[model samples]
Target: MQSLDERCLRYLAEAVGCGSVRAAADKLNVNASAVSRQIVQMEGQLATPLIERHRRGVRATPAGSLLLDYYRRQASDREDILAKLTELKGLRRGHIDVVLGEGFVGDLMSGLLQGFWARHPDLTMTLDLAATNDVVRRVVEDEAHLGLVYNPPPEPRLRTHLAMPHPIRLLVRADHPLAAHPGPVRLADLAGHRLGTMHPAYGIRQIIAAAERAEGVRLDPVLITGSIGVLKQFVASGIGVTLLPAFCAAQEISAGSLVALPLADPGLDGVEAQIVTRLGRQLSPAAGTLLQHLARGMAGEARSGTRRSSSSR
Candidate 1:
């Protein structure tokens, strides 16, 4: 067999990623026939079929999966090499892709991004907001360099760089009745109150569900949404109380518009926010530095929360 063509390899990777040659062509701004031709050439070079089509879309054959994996690693390694060369020139220039849950956006912007960007002005970063599962998938697939998730499930392919306790709290307007609860609020106490919650895709919702099961209760939220902003607005408008980490509503709580109360449920009390990367993957220098900054910032946030809790006591 002849040496494989890089362009053909890229076409194959994109086709598999998009699940169709037409979709890949649309993404790459090329003709579908051109993309298909490249993939066919690649298959001929390898002497094996690269993709199998079904009703839903296309999937890689076992051999195709191996080739795709090799393509991803090669792409990542090339980036690493370029980053190292930039570092050798004393230039802080490289792009870092981060996939994270929407809940982390406020803290990331307020606590980390600006300062990091100021110090490494030549560097570029992309932040993509996704659900917990998508965040993990992107990191594991080499599509992103880092992930910030809340209470993510255990995955062997990921490494946790930092995990900070940011347990679920009952969020309500200051004048709401639950705000005056003397201690941790129990699930039973939430009875007869209006409830708003995120859609099940969110980590907070999953934690809330588990807690409800453990305590043998069910919460039927009047409002269910995929947006954290929507949930915050729902509470602020006095529509109902919602469950979230204290830091998620830090600004509102500090401004006295919303109050975050502890939950009595053990499962909710143990939730954490984590920063993760692909296990065994070497990070670019810029990405590594930003990770350190994020870890420190997150630690500081946790410390601040501790101080606030102590002072309240």
Candidate 2:
């Protein structure tokens, strides 16, 4: 818990994130009137309105953005001080907040989290699973120490540390017809077959759409979902075939339950998985340690993927 003034700042940040006073109050476990009063008092203290209220909800004014930046810096500075103190005590205590894309929340994350906790027994950690854009936003806002994203966009405020170009692969059941192919699958081969995939907002979906266009074929999908797990289930049930990054189905691929056929398209190969951090912010010792671990883990996944693919023959 923070001091009263700091708590007020937290309320402001939450309000900005939520975009509603009532929603922020619900999250903060306080009455809406109290939350409104705190904001009003903060406005008075600063001699300016930090947020502009509208019928839809509220948004930060110029002053609010500035204050939020200062607040984030203060929170970061506190962490840095604690990191130094922990270093003086032999790195016995630290904490890091990481935001990851939903695709990363499965076995890969479980293994990473388990290994990290075991490796750093005295350190605490927080993990948030969100959409790709949300993960990027959290890191850019300084709310998260690190972010893992798929096909990240150009953001001047953020810097990519590890860009792993994970070529999209065709994911299908072991008994599926595509499984007969010994090498990479081309886009035109699937023109008449049913396809299952995520919505267009996802990077994978965008990649698939572009591939379909270049192949000059249009196959209406049998299933269009927002969850990769759902797509995997549908594919398992013989509903349709789908495209996924190698890491997305690593467990099944390794177990021989699912087959990942490489996509032999030039455009599809540019889709990348990246780890990112804020441009000028040097991560604390704890965060920096985890970032390196994650990078190594991802690289290991890629290498193991090559070994698995080659041995499957």
Residues 1-313 of candidate 1 have per-residue lDDT tens digits of 4876788889889988999888999999999999989888888877899999888778899988988888888888888788888888655578899999988988987848988887888989899999888889899889999999998888999999999988899999999999999989999899999888887877888889899999999988899987888989999999899888888888899899999998898889887899999998888888888899899988987898899789988
In the range 1-313, model 2's lDDT, one tens digit per residue, is: 2233887788898888799999999998999998888888888877889999899899999999988887887888788777876777765888889888767876456587778778888988888877777777889888899998888767998899888878888988999988898677888788777888777777777778888899886758878887888888887888789988867877777688898887778888878988999888878889888888888887887677678769966
TM-score of each: 0.93, 0.84
In model 2, pairs of residues that clash are: none
Shift of residue 151 alpha carbon in model 1, Å: 1.1
Best by TM-score: 1
lDDT scores in order: 0.88, 0.82
Q: Which residue pairs collide in model 1, if any?
A: none
Residue 25 CA error for candidate 1 (Å)? 2.0
**How many Å off is the CA of 146 in candidate 1?**
1.2
Candidate 1 contains a number of clashing pairs equal to: 0
Instruction: Mark the regions of model 1 whose C-alpha exceeds 4 Å error after superposition.
Output: 1-3, 44-48
